[model samples]
Structures are given as structure tokens and as C-alpha cells.
Target chain A: MRPILLSGHTRALTQVKYSKDGDIIFSVSKDQIICAWYAANGERLGTYHGHQGALWTVDVDPTTTLLASGAADNTIRLWDVKTGKLLKTWDFGTAIKRVEFSPDGTQLLGVTERRQGHLSTIVVYDIVLDVEAEQADEHSLRIVCEDSKATVAGFSYGSKYIISGHEDGSVTQWDAKTGELLDSAQIQEDDMQITDLQWSSDRTYFITASKDKTAKLVAANDLRVLKTYVADTPLNSAAITPVKDYVILGGGQAAMDVTTTSARQGKFEARFYHKIFEEEIGRVRGHFGPLNYVAVDPQGKSYASGGEDGYVRLHHFDRGYFDFLYEVEREAEQANL
Target chain B: MSKVAGRTDWAEEEDEDSLALPPPQITKNKDGTETIVSYRIDENGKKVKTTRRIRKTVMKQVVNPRVAERKHWSKFGEEKGKPVGPQSDTTSIAENIVFRPSSNWKTNQSEEKNPIDKQKATLKDAKIKCRICSGEHWTSKCPFKDTMAPEGENAGAGAGTGAEEESAAPGLGPSNSSYVPPHLRGKSGVTGERMGGGKFGQERDDLATLRVTNVSEFAEEQDLRDMFTRFGHVTRVFLAKDRETGRAKGFAFVSYADRTDAARACEKMDGYGFHHLILRVEFAKKPTT
Candidate 1:
């Protein structure tokens, strides 16, 4: 699969997401601009421009109506996707690292770092009922680990559990409604930070990409490691196709500083692997810098990735990809014979 | 025959009368013997008489000595130590004059002035300097080579000087300076090591538009939309038609609301059979204008 490149941002990109309906693409960058593009042609539809600092992450609801963006300005702002208007904002009193909506679109999850204590907390607010709900401290379920900071989080496919990944290589599963910690596991060694987490379409398994140069796919119920995708460089983000048994991992040689491109290593491309065999299938090359995020569209036909180079790329699987899988299988069978 | 001879005699007499010379006369004798006499002026202006003889004896001798001389020479020329014995071919003469004397000359010549030595001498005279360290050596052999290594190797050194140089140089100053050492500090603005990716992503946008051809001539916009909506949301459909006739032009454009849908529709509906016509679908190129 060859990727289509989208260019607009001038600074490193932090997050890129496709709307649930797959009609719009939302990307946030360190340049402090949130751009919404038409998913079909990559035409700039509108820009959401209210953030005072660099935006860190963005997530779209299942209906593709509301877009939630978190920024270093210590606030999470929700915008209307169609009208490009700011709908609501929550002051978290700290820098927000990531913000995402529940699969049901009823709650919004934001991971923020307290400036004074240097502690990270996962705050889930009920968005469906109360617009001016008492601050997240009162109405939301706040989950904070004592020492480890949360890096990434996502809701389960059924909205029954919320999985939060920590900087200390630990992953914890919490009950969505009761805010109870159901299970936790150390999925990575060496205290490597988890960069991103992605759930498989069926919710049977989820993969966590870490700074340890590996991405591990684990069974959701027991959190047992299924397969490990290793790379020479740290993997920052990974995504699984909604229907197909394929996973795409994105990273590059680590950047020494956030601003300069002089100290980066490795090529910036999305590496694809067979979900079952864990064998590398193909790679899609783009992005001039390390990739930070990759999100597959809901239909499983295409995926989008953003990187430190500030460009977002959309890749579509061609008919030949399916045929290539069969050809690989035949080659494997011939080897067996 | 007598008349012809009389005519010849008259013509000869006429010529002799004009030149003041003698004319020939033929007379028949009683025994059937004929005698002819003619007179002409000689170089000393004397008249000479000529008589024709009926019977004469002729004798001729031819002498040629070249063949015999060749035989004599061939029989004696093979003697040893003689100049004519086994003459040297042209190649032997040329080899004696040119190659034989010089065969060992190269060995006696100066070995230090060979082609490679001359080339080295010219290079030494030119005094080439290294681009990196500006020394009298190649850049590859520059002493500061370790400083130009990748950032990971020099990370400790870079971190030490990073703070002091951070404010002085903007952009990639600290990062670039850390990799480049003091001896190689003349040229500035050295970007960094080149990262790898497909070069096509430099400026060209990914394939978002698909130009679909081979559409059924009878296919309408709604039919196209109905067939393609299964892949993704249909945004617009443009079917080519004759300007005046208002008839289908055998092709159409079906754009999707999402690029993934357009790609999916192109994959599935291309070569799709519709109303006995196989449809061809592909990404459309951007309009050049």
C-alpha cells in the first residue's frame, strides 16, 4: 500500500485522527493549529484556532460531530466538526497530554500532568448529560497512579473498560462505570514508557507501542502477551486494521530535541506486519521525521499517520495487498513441502 | 584484270607526274611472264629501279636470354653466406630496426618515473587540501573524523556544550556543532545526516482522485452512485456526455466523500460487469490548468 501525503503544518505533529465516519481528518501539531481536512481529497476544510499553546492530541467522537483537542495550555477544548466552533472547554490546571472520547461518545477522557506535583491523572468526564458539570474533580472519575505517569489511554470497543498505559511500562484496566481498577500488568521491560495503545477491531486484543523498541499485542481479558513486534528504533505509535489482520507500526530514529531535525535517525515510514504470524508484510514510506501517531479509518480501508516532520499521510490498501497475502501463504506452504 | 591494272598504272602515272617521280609499268611477254618497273627519288635525289621477283627464300631468327638467365641465377643463388641467399622478409627488417633493440630498454629505464609515480608527483605538486579540516590530506583521512560521526556517539560531548551554544546559534546550531568538531568549523549551516523515506513525498500529494473510465454508456449518475455507495459515502458523480446530443459518453467520474472509499470503489468496481459492459475505475488526475 502506498500512502498519500497531506502537508500543511509547519511544526512537529503530535496527533492525527480520522473521524468515526471517515469523512473528515483532524490533526494537531506543535504549531498550535488544529486542521480539519476532507478525508477524500485532503482539502483544508477549516482550522480550529483557539488554543494558546501547542496542541498535543485530538480525538473525534463516533458520530464525527464533536472533536476534542488537548493542549499544553492546560485545557481541553471541544469543537464542532462541521461548524468549526468551540463548543466547550475544561481547564485542567495542567498540561494535557492526551484526550479521547469513549466509544459510546458519552464520556471524554483526558490525561493531564500536574505542574506542581509532576503527577499524571486520567480524568473521565460525562459529556452526554451535563455541559457545565461540576469540574472533573467532582463529576468525573479520576484515576491517578502514585508514581508512574499515564502516557496514553483508550476505551474498550464495548465501552466496558478503560485501559490506561503508564510511563513505567505498566498497563491498567479500569471499569468504565465504577472507576475500579480491574487488572494491571507490566507489559514492557526496562521501565520504558508506553507511547501509544491501539485496540483491535473485535476488542479481543490490544497493542501497546513503547519506547523500548517493541510493540506487544496482548489479549484483552487476561492481558497475556500474544505477539511482539520488534524494531531497531523505538516505536511511538501502532494501529490495527478494523477488518484485516494487519498492524502498522510507526517510529524513526529518536530525535535529540523537539525542534531540531539534526539528530534524528531511522527512516520515517509505516511498517506493516501480519497480525497472526507477526511477520513483516510491507512498509509505506513518507514523513521526513519520526512518526508520532497513526490511526486507521473506521472502514479499515485506509489509515492516516502524523509525524515530527509536521505532515500527515493517508494510505489506502490496494487490491494487490490481499493477493500478496495469499502469495505469501503459498510461498510458506511451498517451504513446508 | 588487265583493265584494272591499266587503271592502276594510269593513277600511278598521274601521282608521279604531280611529284616529279617515276611510274611503274607492266609488260606482257610472249611466254606469259610479266615484268614491272618503277622509279622513285632517293635521299640523294637519285632514281632507283625496282624489280618484283616471283620466287624468294625467307629466313628469320628470334633470340631471348631472360629465361636462361633466371634458371642460371636460381641454380646458384642458394649458397650460404651469400647476399642473395634467403633474403630477409619486410617484417624482420622492421623488427630489427624498431622492436628488438627496445625490447629490454624498458627494464633499463628509470622505474621511479612510471605512470603511477608521475600521477603522484602531479598530485603532490597540486597540494590538494581536505574539505573537512583544510589540511594537506583527504577529507576521509581528516583527524577530526570522529567528531563527524552520528549524534549517538557524541551525545555526551554534545550535551556538555549544548547549553552554552544553544543561545548563540538558533535552529540546528547546537545539534550540528556537536557533530562537527573545531577543526571543521569553517563551513556553517551544515544541516544533518539525511533521513530516508520515499522521495516522492517531498512535494507530490498522495493519490486521492481516481479517474474512472470504461463506464457503461447507459449507466446514469444514480446507478453509479448506487453501485459505489457501498464502498463509501458518495459525494458527487459526473458522467461525460455529448454536448449537443446529450447522450452518455461511455465514461463517468464517481467521487467519494472519503479517499478510502474512492480507493475501495476503484478496487472493487473496476472491471465490474454492468449491463453487459465491464466498468473501469481508477484514480483521477488533478486538472492541469
Candidate 2:
């Protein structure tokens, strides 16, 4: 599927995600605004504008009722999606880098760069209380890995484990309930920072994008490197389609202060790679700046991407794309016969 | 005993001597002894000290007076045709002051001396005289001729044939010349080619419009207008929608009140990656009809 333009942000976009049903898109930007739009149409449904600083990350729960956002203001705020009302706020005591909801929506996972240390701490809060409860730290667990700052983190499927991507190019797995370090392995060479980590729908493998100019699909059980997708630029974010064997990568030139002649040649578009052969299938070019995040929707019908240009684009896959895939598969089957 | 007494007398006389005295005298005695006497005044200038000495010894000169002579050399025969000395091979001052020719000049000179040089020289010397104007230069460079003429007897043909010949050779017509007046040129009819016939196509002189592409299929006319109106007073927005599906076809044409506003909008919105698409914005071409 090809991408379409949907511009509105006045500053750089930090993250974009789709609601549980894939009918709504949520995007946050450095302009201190969180906006919601209808996935089928480019209509601005509502904007949540209470943050005092630029938002760094955002995520939506499975029920699509609560939205969690982390910001550079050293706070994580929960909002009621339908009403655009701030439900709760927690002073994380550091600039939060990433936030995610546990699969069951019973817990919230947040990674914050430590205020006085070079490391980041992943905190899982027991958020099962009703909307009125104020004490969120009663049953929270803080897991800190020494000598490395976590760049991105996510909960494994069914909340069985928590995996955090670190600036030291390592991916560490932790026991979610006990806050114990289960296993850790270097996912990228040369100490390249891990920019993002996303799990496949089946949870058997998770994909990581790094500054080392490669994205790897790693087996979750043993942390073994399964497949690597190489590119010419540092990948800031990556996503795997839920049903198809496709991986989408987004990145551009390292620095933005390049000459206008060189800046125009930046690979700021989202590139699609075949998950099996690692061949680049297609590219969607629209952003004149670096792409910061790419998120495929729950059903894989559409995907949302945000970039340094302060734009959030929602691309929908056409029916012809799936038909083309089926034709290729059939031709391969015939050739084998 | 008398001689000793005489010497003592002389010593006593020398102590009372004055500064005024003759040159010193030396005498050779029979016993081969030489005696000399000299006088000098004291520091007070009132008394003179006389010094006298006698010894039995032969006189000797401190400096020798003999001259040494060189020995004669044997006669030898001379050899012929030998260089008198090493002759200088240094470059002259004039040659050193002159700058060396560049490599390009040397190459050109070498190339000119090849076998083709004779033919090239002959061709350059062969000049053409124009038949129409009887000028010494070629007909093409002749300014007196009203129309360009063909070579030699071909010019003898009437004006119609001459015109055909001129037309066959492109860019030789008077109409192509910048000096030719627009009204006097052949085929002077206005084809509206200059106004609208370039690569970007004809542009409307009044209404400034922009062709916007890569629009979201879900975008509405109002959304595009709202987005573009920030640059200027947007006069109209036309989102092309599919007839059967009733969805946006992913393109639109936006018009502004002023051309400058349209240009500003294009600069700001072109290549704007929005909603998963990169937008393309440029000046819209006017319809042919």
C-alpha cells in the first residue's frame, strides 16, 4: 500500500499510533499537543493539549479507553480518550523516554532516563485502580540496568516478560512480576544505540531498529538473532506487519544541519522490506525531514508514521496489495510443482 | 794594576756624564776583543749614565744577507688541440630571463607540422566571394543581401526557388534574425505559442492556482482550504473525488487571491509529508479550452 499525506503538527512529531480497532490514529508532537484523527478520513477528531513540555512517546490500550503519554516534562499522564480529559499524572522524576500499556491494561510500563545517573529505569505501575485512585506507587516495580540507558521498552505478549532496548545496544529481558533480570544480550555490534524495539503479533520474535544501520528480528525465547534488514541510514523506528511478511523501517541522515543539496537526498521515507528474503520491496517518500517513528496498526490494514518534519501520515493498504502478494505466492507454488 | 785603576776611573767618570753625547763607538783590539760605549740621561735630566762593555769574542751578524736562486727546468714538447681551460656551458642571461613556452603551445606546434597541415593551409587560403553582393566574404556573412542566397548558379533561380532553398537550410531565414521586425517577418501570425506553449504549459495571468497532489483520499475540500488559507486568502479549493467511490482521488487544485500567495503556499506545503503521504505542490496549468 502507498502512503498519503495528513499534515497538521507545527513542530517535530515524536510518535504516532493506532487505536485498538485501527479506526483512530493518535499522534504526539514536540509542540506539546496530542491529536486524534479518524483513520478512515483525515479529520482532526480532538487534541489533548495539557502537557507543559514536548511529548516524547504515546500509546493506547487494548480497550481504546485510556491513552498513556510520556513527555520531556518528567511526567507521564493518562487521559480518557473519548473525552480528552486528563485522568491521572505521575511525576516520573526524569524525562520519560517511552511508555506502553501492558497487554491486559492492568499495568503501565514506563522507561525514564535517570535524573542523576547515566542509566534509565523501567517502572511498571499497578494501574488496576479505578479512575479515582491517587496512590499509584503502592505496587510499582522499578528495574534499573547499570551502565546503560534504556532507549525504548515494551511488554512481551500476555505480559509474561518486559524487554528494554538500551543505548549500549543491548536488549535485556526481565521477569515482569518479580522485577528480576532474566537474560540480556547485545543485539547490535559496536555499541550502537537501539532506537526502537517492537514485538511481532505472535510474540515469538521481536524486531529492533538501531543506529548501526540494521534492524534485526530476534527470537524471543533465546534472544538469538534470526534475520537482519540492512539499510544505508540509521533506522530510528521499525514495525512488522501483523499478517504479512513485511518490515517497515524509517530513518534519515544523522544530522539535520546538512547542506540543502545533501538534505534533499536524505532517505527520510519509510522503506518496506520482505521479512523472509530481506529484500527491500517498496518505499514511501513524503517527509522532507527525518522520520522518527513508524507504527503499523493492529489489524495491519493501515499504518501511521511521524517524523522530524512535524507530520503524522496515515497510510492505508489498498486491496490490490494483498492480491499482488497472493499472485506471487501462487506463482512460486506453481514453479515448485 | 794600572789598567784596573784606569777602569775604576772611567766608571767614576760615567756616573757624572750628561745627556749630550756623540754616537756610540766600537773598537776591535789586537786581542780580538771589541769594546763599545753609549750614554743616556737620567729621569731628572741632570746626570748621564754611560754603559761600556768589552769581551774577547768574534763579531756575528743576527740577520743573513744571502739570496736563494731557483733551479732551471728541462725543456718539454707541447701537445696540440687541447682545450686551454674548462669552457663554461651555463645558459646565457638572456635565455634564463625568457619564460619557457607552455606544453599546450608545444603540442599545437607539433600538431601543425603533420601531413594534414598542407591541406588545412590550402583550405584556409581559399576564400569565397558572394555572387549576390559581389563581396569578398562568403555569402552567409554578407550583410548587403536582403535574403540569404544559395551557393553559385543555384542563386540564378528565381526568388521562389531561392526562398525554398533558404527554408531547407534551417536558421538561415531573415525571420530568425533578431534584427528582423516582427511585423515584416514571414508567417508573422500569432499562434499563442509564446504565451502558453512551454514545458509547464499555459498559465493563467489572473487567478493564481496551485496543483496539489498526494492528498489523503479522506481529505475534504474544507480541510484543504483551511490548510492553504493560512498563507493567503484562498479563493477556491477543488478536491478531485472518485465518481463511483465518492472518495477523494488524492489531488486538488487550490486558488489564491494573489500569485505571490499561491507561490508562498507552494513553497510551504510542497513535499509536506502529511498523514503518511508526501504532498506535491506546483503552479497549476491553465486548461487548453
Candidate 3:
């Protein structure tokens, strides 16, 4: 399969995501710009250019009209996706590490970085869907990360609970409405930090990629680990494909960290692992440097990856991807017939 | 056409609006295809014509209204006022990759590497090839082995380097293979020497060979042999010919079974007129190399 390469970012890419319909792709980089591209081709839709500092995270509301981004400037800005107009900006004490829109378009959650005597916190805001309406200046609820700073946080299905992966290898769940701690579990290694957390299609379970070179599927309600997929290199991001029972993991060592490692050891690839079996099936290799993020299309048509080389590659699945079947799976299909 | 109301630069005065080439022609074919022919002036001031035939098919895909509306939205930010389509500077297509997945994909990858291991899996289906006749049999069992000299010496290789080694005296053919004739097989140094050390051995003595010159270009090896056979039992007759013209090169070698007989023929052949030219005959000297 041929991959369409989008080279709009001037610096390493931090995140790339597909719209709900899988027609648009939004990417944010450390170069302080957010780019939107049409998924059918590599045509660029537009760019949002109001971030003062390097951007770290970006998220789109369910309706795809409102776009939110958090940056190292310690501010989260909202923008109109169609016109790239700046709508609102919320200031914080520290830089926001992660930002995610709740399942419903009414709320937004952000994880603030712990720095300069400011405690890491998870804050939620009531978002107004109308572009002309004024947004609330104050946060509706805030939860202090007392033990470990949360690196990633997302609202559960129906906005019931908020799940956060911490820097200390623990995943904690908090009440979405009351902002109270509920359940916490050490899902990863003792001190290995979790780098990324992503939810399944239904949002009942989520996968967390950690510095321990493994990603775990954890339930959203009780925070119990279900399946663990181990990899050779430290993973930076992980995404579960919707149609196929496969999980794509993106990771590698930064070339500067270990100068003596071989190119293969610095695994610059997106590995596909069978979700239930935890066996690595295949890998797609193209990035010059380590992959920073991987996002699959919600409609199961394609997947896109952002790399430290400052390029986003969109790959559409070939017929072989859908035709592949395990022996046992083939037998079960025949029995059904 | 450009929107330049007036030209400010004198050297570029509205030449871009002028067209010296012919207009493109389009034709509809009976097979539901369109043929388009276009002409242009190339960089070398040469007129070039291009023709293309294409079939058009309509594909319908129903998408959500929100997505349909978003597709027509105007471009903004850095791409403002730009035409619709992928920009060349920011977008490109990468090379194709084969990513077929299988349960035993790991084993499939490692098997392609070490060829010796793959040889075992294919050994039962392997086919035999005869080096001499290229038939399906072993080289030693080929019917053309004795008649063809194993098909290697017939290539006109000039002078083989292995001949300089003289590893086993001189033989009828180059020792490219280790196959010894049925006579020489299982024989040690004593029995081999009695047979004159090689296939040609004592019968191929260089002393009994005579080099004949001033021969006619139309002369054949058999003609030279007939003329010299009256004086001695002719062992072998070799004629040098032109590779391109395939004509005799005015020289031939005639070997006799006995040196005394070769001397008689050399004396008789010298100064003998043939083809209106006098012939010269002398003992053939072995190459020092």
C-alpha cells in the first residue's frame, strides 16, 4: 500500500488525530501550529496560528466544530475548525500536558503539568457549543494529583468517570461530576511512566502505553488490567483499531539518548499486534526517526502516524489486511456458515 | 489567462497571453472512451504532440451532510486564497510497500534468508541437468560427452590459461571436471605412464609435427593431410582459419607418427609449388609459454 505523506510541520510532531467521520485529520506539533488536512488526499484544509508557545496537545469536540489545544504557554485555546478563528483562551498556572473533549460536546478536560511549585491537576470546564456564546472563565471542577502527576486523562463513556494515566505507572479513576478519587491501580511497572492513554470505540476500556515497553488494556470502571502487549522498544503512543482486532503501537528511543544503538533497535515503526492474542503480527516502517503518535480512523478505513521527523503519513489498508484470518477464526466462520 | 491589466516589464510584454501552438483536439470513441491530443513547444524549440485515451466512470458515495458541507468550506490561514487540491510543497506519495500479514509471518520472514535451509524443502522437487547436452541427466552419463568435448572447448576460447599449468601433461580436453576416462580410471602413476601420461601422450609428440606455410586461403585440412600422407602416417592435421571470414590463414600443422617420416615430408613439401605459390615446411616448435 502507498502512504500519503503530509509535510506541513516544521518540527517534530506531537499528535495526529482523525475526525469522527474519518474525513479530516488534525495534527499539532512543537512548532506552535495546528494543521487540518483532508483524509482522502494529503490536501491541507487550513492551519490555526494563535499558540504563543510550543503546543503539546489538541482535541476536537464531537461535532467537529470546536477545536481545543493546550500549549507550553500555560494556556488552552479554543478555535473554530471551519474558519480557524480564535474563540476563547483559558490561562493556567503550569503548561497543560494533555487536553481531551468529553464524549458529549458540553465538557472539556485538561491535565496540567506539575512545575514551578504548582501541583499537577485535572480540571474540567463547561463548554458552550455555540461559537458566539461566551465560555465560562472559571473551571467547574478540579482534582489535585497529589501522589503522581497525571500525564494523560480522558472522560469515560457518557461522561461518567474520568480516567487518567499517571507518571508513576498508575491509572486512577475519578468521578466526572464531583471530581473525587474513586479507584487507582498500578497497571504498569513500579516507576515506569505512562506516556499515552486512548479509549476504545465504546469508551468502556482504554489502552495505556508506558515507558516499560508495554501497553495494557484496562477497564474504565474498576481500573483492572485485561491484556498486556509487550514490545521491544519503549512505546510513545498506542491505538486500538475498530474493525480489526489489532492494536497499533508507536515507539522508539530518541537517537540522542543512545548514540550506540543500531537503527533497528531504535525501532522507528508502527507495530500491529493481535489484541486478544497479544502476538505481534506485522509492522509498517517508513519514518526516519521514532514515531511519536499513531491514530486509527474511527470508520476503519485507514491510519495515520506522526513521527519525530516532522512528517505525517496516512496509510490506507490493502485487501490483504482484511483477508487475513487465523486458522481458528476461519474454522469458526465456516461452522457459522 | 493571467489577470495582468498592464505590463510593467518591457522584456515580458504580454508574451504569456500569446499562443503559438494548436488548440487541443478531443474525440469520442465508439468504445465509450475519449481521445485527447495536445501540442506544445518543448524547451529545445521542438514541437511535441501528446495523445491520451481515457474512460470516465461515475462513482457515488453517500456521506454525512456535515462532512459534505465541510468539504466545500473555504481555505483559511496559510492556505488562504489558494486553489483546491493538494499542494506540491506540502504533500507527496511514498513508495509502495507489501504488508501481508499471516499467523506464521515471523517464520515466513526468516525462511527467505538462509538459502541452504530452503534447499532442503525443495530437494524432493529438484530437477537434474546435464552439463554436456543440457538434458535431464547427470553430466557423466550424457550421450554427447565423448563426441562434444563437454561443450566448453567448442567456444573458441583462444588459449586456455590452465593449459600453461601442464598439471597432468597434455590431454584431449581441458580438465574442467574431475572425470577420468574408463582407461585412466583407478590407474596409478605406473599404469598411466605406460599409456604415455595423458590422452594424447606419446602419439601427440611435438617433434613429429611440421608447420606448413604459404598455403592457399581456399585449402582445407583434408587437402593438406592427403598431400603429406604419402610420406608418413598422419596423426593429426590442424589449420588456422580467420574467425570472421572462415578462410584458411595460409598456415597448417601436420603431425606424423614418426619424426623421421615428418622430416621426409618437410623436405618434399618445401619449395613445392601449389596454387601458383611456393610452399615452406619446417618442424613445428612447441610454444615456450
- TM-scores for every candidate against the unseen true structure: 0.51, 0.53, 0.70
What is the alpha-carbon lDDT for the whole of candidate 3? 0.83
Question: lDDT, candidate 1, residue A169?
Answer: 96
Error of model 3, residue A293, in angstroms = 0.5
Q: Please say which candidate is ahead in DockQ: 1 or 3.
A: 3
Backbone clash numbers for all candidates listed: 10, 11, 0
**DockQ numbers for every candidate?**
0.00, 0.00, 0.53
Query: Residue B198 in candidate 1 has what lDDT?
Result: 19
Enumerate residue pairs that collide in model 1.
A4-B206, A40-B259, A253-A265, B209-B284, B210-B282, B210-B283, B210-B284, B211-B282, B211-B283, B211-B284
Looking at candidate 1, what is the lDDT of residue B87? 29
Candidate 2 at residue B274, lDDT? 68
**Which candidate number has the best DockQ?**
3
lDDT by residue for model 1 (B76-189), tens: 111223333222220011111111112122335456336788898787678645543233456677544443322223222323323323322222443543555544444332
State the C-alpha lDDT per candidate: 0.68, 0.71, 0.83
Q: Judged by TM-score relative to the true structure, which candidate is superior, 1 or 2?
A: 2
TM-score of candidate 3 versus the correct structure, residues matched by position: 0.70
Better of 1 and 3 by lDDT: 3
Cα lDDT of model 1 by residue, A1-337, tens digit: 4455666677888998887666567889998878876555454556787899999999987766677899999989887765566778788778899888887788899998755765788888877533334323344788876668888988886778888888999898888788888999999975899999887766667899999988999877777899998866788999887776778899887766434543323657677777777766555665668889998877776788898877787666566554444456678978999
Q: In candidate 2, what are the lDDT values of residues A1-337, reduced to their tens digit? A: 4354556578988888887667678888898878776665455556786889999999888777688899999889888776677888888678988999887888998899866744578988877534555636543888887768888988887788898889989998888888899899998975899998987876668899999999999877678989999987888999998767788999887645433536546878788777877767666777778889998877887777888877776777765445435356678978999
Model 3 chain A weakest lDDT span, ten residues long: A255-264
Task: Summarize candidate 3's per-residue lDDT along B49-166 as a digit string, tens digits.
Answer: 8999999899888999988999999999998998999999888999997787778766675667667777886995676766543445687985445433343332112133222223
